[model samples]
Target: MARHPVRAKDFAVGEEPATVVVGLIASPGPAAEMAEALVGGLARQMGERLPGARWSVRVVADRLVGGPAPLHELVARTRRRLLDGGWQLAVFLTDLPLQTARRPVVAHASSAHGVAVLSLPALGAVGVERRADEAIVRLVAVLVGGGDAPVDVKPSGDDGGGKHRDALLRRLRELGTVAGDDRGAGLVTGVITGNLRLLIGMLRANRPWRLAVELSRALVAAVAAGVFALVTNDIWLLADNLGWLRQTLVGAGSVLAVVLTLLLGADLWERAPPQRDPEVVRATREQVVLLNAVTVTTLVIGVLALYCALFVLSLVSVLLLVPPGLHAAALDHPTGFSDQVELAWLVSALATLGGALGAGLESDETVREAAYAYQPDRSLTG
Candidate 1:
């Protein structure tokens, strides 16, 4: 008798094809949100793109990488979780920027362990979700296709001549350059474009605006100093005579002063130890420099926000208390909205300087915590 083709449902439960479970372990906040949102889509894509396997995805919101650790250690930890959870593959997504002594790393995959770690900041500020989706897919493909022959191999029951695998590999190359021998871990380092993009991503992940909110004491001091400046004739005279150039210099100087005071007072700067190995020392120095840069940028942004707020308040005070005629008479010149704006600008600068004094009240831990939510507990030598 003619035989019909065998169907999947016709097979016994035990004889059915094995399902490949993929786990997404994400750091708290943005990384976790992205992982949760992408899990469903990723499962569908994995099933469609890598044929002949029943694919499933699970997202766990946890901090897998709190600080810098050896790449192998990170992979091993992830591997343990994968095995314990009965997952075939695992990926850890972190918002913190990852760098090697050579370059910033976008992703690291250990095919031997069936685990991957991706730095979200390396993907840039825009289209992070899309890029992350593509990155996870490529990583999954790498793990499934085998590390040695990532691009050339065809999936089981796939007769399309490895086109899908080649396409995934091509996309991965576009994201970053794959390095390291196939016998162990593989690294994907960003190019120049990727580096610039990574910097932007890091800045966003820092969430500089939070610094403004945390500086409650400083904001109060600034408002007090601004109110004192607004009612003084001397400040009005200074504002009237100080040209735009002088005003700009004063504002910049005030911002610099506040940033310096915070950095020094809070001990936010990282200092490398003298007794560590030479390689560790060098890596620590590099990381310290990068962390300091990010911290300084965050402070500047926060101080500028404070300055803008002071300026608005000063302007309103000027409008309400100092009449246009009085402002003109005090400066011995005709005054208009421009005069009011200049006056507000000068007062804001002076108030920002006063805010610097208040920064002393904030503890080192508070500023550090505010500025770096994902800051490393200890610098990684690698």
Candidate 2:
């Protein structure tokens, strides 16, 4: 049986554990969340790798220190802040999209210092915190230099095959030299486990209440659309003449059309000019903007759904409120239940159009912030 060389005992630094403080920069909400997760995971991973190390994580709030700046400059500024603040490490987590060779890189660490930057977009709708944990561990490995084994940070999809993988691995090895030597195989397996853990964590994070709050405004628009659909009688005859399938398609198509219109008018594709002082590359920023646009579109779809439901309820109200004979009299060529069904669908389409007004009522900043989960103008108080 082969013995595993890297274990808890191998990391025992001394009786006195060293403490490392990490500074987090970015949007307040997400930065705070990321800071909490990173700090929590440090004791678990680093304790095994460096048993005598203690880690503290805090979100940085000083305008003089944090904001949407170029990565190199952000890192340099953060380094100075951390050092002056008597901290050991600084990590800037940004929602800004980052890519290398058209492929997303989740994180990058400076070889000369204990500073690192991670992109939120690279987390890609999964165990974001778990990926962060793994990336942080890899960063620490490079900064502290304990494990002699080469570190591999390539994300799941690498198109370069053998040469690319080998070159990246060599570059990582050259980053720093550590005290212990272990085959790279175990480290690879650990990272794979980290990815799996992230998937599960994301699943748990998606609770119903959070989703409800996120879509509350959209739901309000849907209800308003439904109300407008119920009260209007001009389209009843057209609806009565149309087939169920056609009605559904019309309703769905209307919702989609309005959504596209909103996306175009919203200017989600606009990008900030490149900065020279900090020197940043925004190759993947458009993709992030596109994603936010889609999110806003989804809200439009949700409003349409609400409007349909309310329209149905309003139609039912008509049936209950008005006498059967009266409803038939109201329709010129009424066909009983069939006429009502047609009327409902036709009204839904129009109501969905009205929902566009509600969407427009939403402030552009609100929609943008909701789409990305980051409040750009928000400043940390106290």
Model 2: residues with Cα > 4 Å off, grouped in runs: 1-225, 265-301, 369-382
Worst 10 residues of 1 by lDDT: 179-188
- Residue pairs with backbone atoms closer than 3 Å in model 2 (clashes): 127-198, 145-178
Candidate 1 runs further than 4 Å off? 1-194, 275-282, 374-382
Tens digit of lDDT per residue, candidate 1, span 190-268? Answer: 2223333333344555667777677777777877888899999999999988899999999999999889988898776
- Cα lDDT tens digits, model 2, 1-382, are 1212222442335423335455655445675567665665665665454323455556664433344454445445545554444445566676665333223455655433345666676666788777767666665554443222333333324454334333333322222111121224443343334223222222222221232134445556656666656665656546665778888888777677556545654544333344343212221122123223334534454445555565676578656654656556667544576666667667667666665665566555444333322111111111
Taken over the whole model, the C-alpha lDDT of each candidate is: 0.66, 0.48
TM-score: model 2 vs. ground truth:
0.42
RMSD of each: 16.1, 15.9
Point to the candidate with the largest TM-score: 1
